[model samples]
Target: MKNILTLSLVTLSLTACVNRDNQYDYIETPQPNQVADLQDDDTDGVINARDLCVATPDESEINNEGCGIIITSSNERHLHILFSNDSADIQPIFSSQIRQMVEFLELYPETSIEIQGYASKVGNEEYNLALSKRRAEAVDRRIESMGIAADRVTVVGYGETHLEYDGDDEMSHARNRKVTASVVGYQGDIKKEWTIFSRLPK
Candidate 1:
């Protein structure tokens, strides 16, 4: 009985010591979830943060973080004018469209348009080259006559090189002979603006 009591006392003391020394601790968390901050570049209510020019810029514009840039937009660089089998005359029907574009450019004095001309694959390479150049120059003169500044218009020719359409048929050849009125540095209607807290570049 004395041995039994000694064993019980020893077990109780061991149990008490184990329970006293038991340990526990809490773990810390990392950074929390957050949203992107928006800022106003243009005074327009639409934040520039959501602007297409900021998120995805066309060839004409580049997004340097929050600060935006306007470069030459590729879409406005060419206006094709079809020739009469081998002529460089600016089509009468296309005149009105050219006039409207010139007027828009006039409104934005800082903007400019580049005119490119192409010819069909009918003539010899050298002839086609000269013809295309003439076509582009013709369009440039016509636009200049409309009172647009000479400096704002650039004329160039790309012989039957980059055809809009390709085939052995006349229809395809017709497509090849054309001029382009490419407007550069002109921003469309400012439908929205973005206000973004841009991080400074390292």
Candidate 2:
């Protein structure tokens, strides 16, 4: 009877101690400010709260922040062809430019360009529009002769609508007669350009 009484008391004391410690040491779990399952709008595999770049490009390898780590760059694809007044003939001085067009077309077979032709602001708008168009076609013909398909190069005459030099003076007018273009292509979803450089004989 005496041993039974002592065991009961000891058990009660242990239970009391445990309850007291639990009351002091126990902590509640913290709740988040946002919902746990927000949408990944960019499909970058990261949720909005954790993603620093929310609109990451598709298929770009992303970090925890959902931004691309693949470093990329862009090169200028500007094309310019200067012309003598009233002449649609491409000068011999632009041989380098012609090669540039040919090589670029060969490399990216699917790419195409629209040659925008411009004339000096001093000429008649109607007449200049026609002249500019001829200039654009002249470039197309040159490129077409070099072996790029006719379908790959399109031409448009903007005339003096968008001028490099917006003045009616002689020098400024001379500066405005030109054909220009830019070329671009996509291997996957990435836009790409190439610059073919040649070393001139010193």
| Best prediction by TM-score | 2
Q: Give per-model TM-scores.
A: 0.53, 0.55
- Please identify model 2 stretches exceeding 4 Å from their true place: 1-76, 188-202
Best by lDDT: 2
**Residues 134-175, candidate 1, lDDT per residue (tens digit)?**
998988888888898899888788888877787979899888
What Cα-based lDDT does every candidate model obtain? 0.70, 0.80
For candidate 1, the per-residue lDDT at 42 reads: 52
Candidate 2: 10-residue stretch with minimal lDDT: 186-195
Our tally of clashes for model 1 stands at 25
- Residue-level lDDT for 133 in candidate 1: 86
Clashing pairs in 2: none
Report the error of model 1 at residue 117, Å.
Answer: 0.5
In the order shown, what is each candidate's alpha-carbon RMSD? 14.3, 12.1
